[model samples]
Every structure is written in C-alpha cells, then in structure tokens.
Target: MYGHDNKQFFGNNKLLLPEQPVHDDFLDTMEKVFHWSCIFGVFGSKRYISILWSALILASLVVIEYLAIWKVIRAVTGVARDTSGHRSITARLAGTIFYSISIMSLFVASKLWYYWRSNISLLWAKVERSVGVKVPADSTLKRRLYLVFGLMTFCSMFEHTVSMIASVGLDCPSSLLMKRYVLVSHGFLFMGQDYSEWFAMPLILISTLASLLWNFQDQLIVLISIGLTSRYYRLNGFVAKLCELEKHQTEFNKKSEALKVYTWRKIREAYVKQAMLVRRMDGALGGIVMLSCSCNFYFICLQMFLGITQGLSTDVMTGIYYVVSLAWLCTRVISVVLSASGVNTHSKTALKYLYTYETHCYNVEVGRLQDQLTKDYIALSGMGFFYLNKTILLQMAGAIITYELILIQFDGQGQIDTETTPSIHLNVTNI
Candidate 1:
C-alpha cells in the first residue's frame, strides 16, 4: 500500500542518467593530466618551482608583452606598421570586451583566492557538523577541478600563440594588441624599444601565458565546482530512488530485513554527504558566480562573433582552425549548462519519489527533505539576478542570430557603396 503511489508517480526512466563512476573517474584523471602537461609544455619545468621565481618570470613577461615585442617585430620586418585593420570599430569593440573580461577575471580570481583560503576551513567545519555528515575530501574531484583550471590556462596560451603566429606568418595586422601600442609600457616607466625580435618573442610568449593563467585558473575553479555539484545532485537522486525501492520490498525475510536496514543507512549517508557537498560548493562559489556568469555570457557571445568572422578567412587551414576553436568553446559552455540542468532535473525526480512515498507512509525526514527540495531546487544564480540554465543558451542563440543579420546588412550596404562609387564620380564630372 505504501508504494502503490510509487508506480502512479513515476513511470518513466528516460530522463535518468546512468551512473558510470569508472568512466567518470577516468575522464577526470585524463583532463587533469592533460592540463598540467600543457603548462609544462609551454613553460619550462622550472616555472612551477618557486613562487618568487615564478613571480619574476611573470613580471618579465609583462614587460615584453606591453613594451618590447611589437617594436622588435616592426624593426625586423622593416614594414611601416598599418593600424587600419585593428583600428576598425569592430576590432576596438572586440578588444575592449576581451581586456575587460580578462582584467575582471584576474581581479575576481584574487578575491576568490583570498575568500577560499580564509573560509574553506570554516566551511568544512560546517559540513562536518551538519547532522554528522562528513564529506571526505574527494581527491579525484579535486584533481578534476584543477584540470579545468589547467585547460583554461592552455586555452589562453593557445589563443595567444595562434595570434602571434597569425600576425607573423599570415602578415595579419592588428593594432589593438598591447605589444603594438605605447600605452602602458612606454610612457609611465619610459622603457626603451631597443630590443631585438628574437629577444622579445620568447618574453612575449611567456608573459602572455603567465598573465592569464592565474585568471583563467580562478574562473575555472568556480565553473568546474558548479558542474561537479550538479553531478552530485544526480547522484543524490539515484540514492533516493534506491532507498525508496528498498523501503517498498514486500519479502520481509530475515536477510531481506537486514539488507533493507543496511541499504537504507547507506542511502541516507550518501544523501546527506551529497547534499552537503552541493551546499558547500554553492557557498564557496556564490561571490564569483554572479559576475563570472554575466561576464561569461558576453564573453561567449563575443567569442562566437569572432569565431564567425575568423572562420571566413581565405586560408582553408586558418578557417578550419578557427572553426575548431569555436567548437571547443561551445562545448565548454554547453557542458556547464547541461550540468546545471541535470541538477534541476534530478532533484525534481527525487522530489517526485518522496511525494509519492508521503502519500502512503508519512515520514518526518522525508517531509523535511521535500520541503527543502521545494524551497531550494539546485540552481546556480548570478548574484540572485539571473539563474544559469539551458534558457541562457536560447537567449544567446537569439542574440547571435540578430547580430549576424545586422552584420549581413552592413556588408551588403558596403558592397552597394563600393559598386556605385565610380558612377557617382562620373555623374559629378559631367554635371
């Protein structure tokens, strides 16, 4: 009688995600190893040796990027620098967005680092005390999170590397780059432009890599945590389902009773730990999520625009490379959204099971969990302003479509002007 409502409440398992711990663990490990490999590949083995050494290397890199590299390149090429291409309105707008997000990421990372270091111990204490639920430090999950930071670092490095290559190999002219202008590096400190391109190249590469690595690393920590927490929510749902099924067994033999009791306790323990992990993650990530998500929305949009523009290059390889890069970015964004949505879906499923059980057998803990579930569905909110969900994807799609249409119109108008210019000049001469 207790679980008669179970069948009535839940008939479909189509939306459920199957548990695959081995596969997940393998992926987690692989991503971490790949990320670290990128860091070591770009920088030398000594880069991670000491904070002081690392700081000095990073400072040197900043100088090269902001001051020396472009001048050296210009001197060697002996070509009077052309600023027209990168001075275009779209280019300036793109640069503004890039630097704004990048700088914000750095600032946010610093604050978050401080917060995480200071509050993490207290947060762990809270989790430990929370109904005796002690979530063990998941080394695998920790490594996976670190991997995300590494991946983001590698992405920044890859982008900068390609930009440098394109500028040299393809003769791509871009004035918006910091190395090209005398804004920060030349005026205030009065640094000289006497460096050779050979000297500047390595410095430029290292500096760009170092500057953004920490920023991206910081952002990805919050991002990956959000994703991991979502997965735990689903795990919680699975545990809940198992618990409900265990409770509904009709065969009440001695071994069956013992198994049921043991299983129920394990499920309860699991449910508690999973919930604690999600809550702790949410608490730790709350401050950065708002700004991060807002910035990410715009950043993703800008990236999409750049990707489309870049993909239209005359060089087939260049076009393909850009397309692949865009695909990579899209995959990351989609993964975040899907992870968040998974939490919502699974929590609701868990709630469904609880509600049905309540209809037949009244349990105080079930009612409390149901209330909590109803009140706080596992959604990531941006400073309580906007919730990250699949709907953001739809909004982004609409924005992309609108922007593309406008770009098409502008291109058509430019073509019309070019075509009619000679005729207009001829008519003026005749008059």
Candidate 2:
C-alpha cells in the first residue's frame, strides 16, 4: 500500500516508502559502524587518550581531597583518640601534603591534556581537508597516541599515590560519624537506607574505594555519548546542505527548459537524483537522533527518580540535593525543547526554500530567498540561541543558591553557650 504512485496522486511530490524497509538490517549495520568508527577514531587519537588520562587523574584528585577532608574531620572530632596528639598531627600533615600534591598534579595534567587535544584535533582536521579523505591510520598517529597514554598513566600514578596515602590516614570514629550523617541524610532522602549502619566502617571504606574507581569510567561513557550525538547533528546538517544544493540545480534546469528542453531536462534529472541521495542521508541521521534521545531520556529519568525518592524525604540534611536535581531537570527539559523547536524550524525553512527553487526556476531572483533561508537556518540550528543557554546558566545559579540556603539553615546558626536574664530588682524599681 505504501507506494510512490500513491504519493504522486497528491501534492506530496516527496518520495514515499514503507517505514519498515528490506534494507533495515543494512541500515542498522551501517549505523553501528558509524558509531564504532567515531569512537575508535577519537579514542585512537593521541589527544583523546591524553584527555581520558587527565580525567582519571582529576577523579583521583577528587578522591584524595575527600580523604584528606575526612582525616581532618577525624582529628577535629578526636575520633582517633591519640592521647599524645602526635599521631593526629602526623596524619593531618601527611594528608594535607598528599592532597596538595594531587591538586597540583591534576591542574597540570588537565592543562596539558586540553592543549594536546586541541592542537592535535586542529592538525588532523587540516590534514584531512588537504588529503580530501578521512584521517589516516598512521604510525605517526599511533606514536603520538602512545606518548599521550604514557603521560596520562604517569599523572594517574601520582593521583593514585595520593589516594593511597589518604586511605591510610582515615580514622574510624570520624569516618563513622561522617558516614552516619551522609547516609542518614542523603540515603534517607534518595537511597532509603542508612548504609553506615547496615555496613561496618571497613565495608563502607571498601565500597567508597570501589565507587571512586568506577565513577570515572561512567563519566567517560557519558561524555562519549554526548560527543557522538553532537557528531550526528553535524553530519545531518552537512547532508541537508547537499540536498539543498541538488534542489537548486534541479530548479535551474527546469527554468532552462523554456530555451533548451532536452539538455536542461537531463541536468534537472541528475540534480533530482542527487537530492534523493541527500534525502536518504538525512533519513539515516534521524536514527542517530532517536537513539541519542532515548539514552539521554533514560539517564534523566533515573536521576530524577533517585533524587526525588531518596533526597527530598530526608529529615536530617536540608533539601539541597532535591532542589539542585529539580533545577537540573528543568534545565534539561528546556534544552530539549529548544533543540526540538530549532530542528523543526530548520526543516520548515528547508522545505520552503526547496518549494521556492522549484517554482521560480531560472527566472526567479533568488538572492532575497537565499538570505531568508540563511537566516532561518541560523535560527533553526540554535547555534546562537543564547536564551536556552542562559536558561541552563540560570538553573545552575539557582542550584548554587539552593545549596547555600540549605547550608545556612542547617549549619549557619550561631552557638549559644550561656543564657542571660534581666535583673528582677532593677525592673521592679523602674516600675
């Protein structure tokens, strides 16, 4: 029932095909190949490896900082109960030294990684343009890649060392108190259980260490997914441009038909064929968007559920996490709405441009139409859509404010060591 003949009867000059096609398997394979290629291409690059390493180092630094803070809290709480105070002082000093080293290493590693990635990507883009081909799988690229990997490994080593030192300095009582607060507060609001009570300090310590190790990998996966989605959008844009060019050629040929019918007709047919190819390319890109959206939506839902279920209901900690999560969700929704609107606007403008091209042909003055089309494209692409960007910025600002409010409500109250009353005798004399 889905046929081109049916499409021809109506004003729908657009090609019609069944949603489920015989080439579905082939299309799926191609899409997978595209994703894997992009992943490997980026990962195989020296720059990306450096970045990955730097990210790991940063994660390590975060862990080290947490440990150092834990140690300091223990000392303040007298959890170690060292009567001499010598052990506490030594642990604090050691933790501070290691944390400082980790922080400095992380900073240097991040800068180096950024510089390397940017420079390498720039060089590769130029080389690809010059060669008129995709980047080569070359020995030089591999060598550079190895160098980046080695650098990243070295940076990670320092961070790991800091984490190890911090681990050794952890005090049982301070750890228990911190765990109780975090678990009773965050867990009750989000996780629904006090992990500190359910699990002993040693088990909690092990779990924390495991989480630190795994969280970086999870973050990397997220980053990679985002990068792939961006690439899909860019590729779709290019394909759309090609389609517009072909449509332009077809219109030029139709107009020339008045003078030279046969020659112009052939040229128009060629353009139409090219346009069809571009349409197919555009269709392929739709799959990418669908997949990316599904993944993002899943993440959004999971995070929202966790935040609401565990975080909001907690009595001990103020509802800062809940507020931040809510704001983030709102920000994400706004971004999605903006992106969808932009894409729809782009599609409409493209169709309009095509219609104008077909109807006006060579006799039509296209400069004004082209200008309008360009403006529409710019607006639809959301490249300069500051409003949506600002929405996210404001949401983050709100999150910070909410966090501060929570802190002030919970921890900012002044301590009263003693109570005072007015002298009764003085008051009686005044009366």
TM-score, candidate 1, is 0.60
Please give the RMSD of candidate 1 to the true structure.
11.3
True lDDT of residue 91, candidate 1: 34
> Cα lDDT for residue 371, model 2?
44
lDDT of 1 by residue, 1-431 (tens): 22353332223421121122233442344244334433312222233553344455545544433433344344336542432333223333333344334344444544444444466434444433332222223445655556665676666556545534433334435644434322212211123354344544554444354435423533444454444554465445554565466466443345534433443344455455556655565565555566555554554454444445444543553454455445545655665566555545555556666656624334445566667667765555555565666687787668767866665566567621222111000000000
lDDT of 2 by residue, 266-355 (tens): 223323332333233223233323332333343343334334433445332223433443454444344443443443343334334344
Error of 1 at 197 (Å): 3.2
Candidate 2 Cα misplacement greater than 4 A, ranges:
1-42, 47-292, 299-312, 316-318, 333-337, 340-344, 353-431
- Which candidate wins on lDDT? 1
All candidates: TM-score: 0.60, 0.28
lDDT of 1 at 33: 38
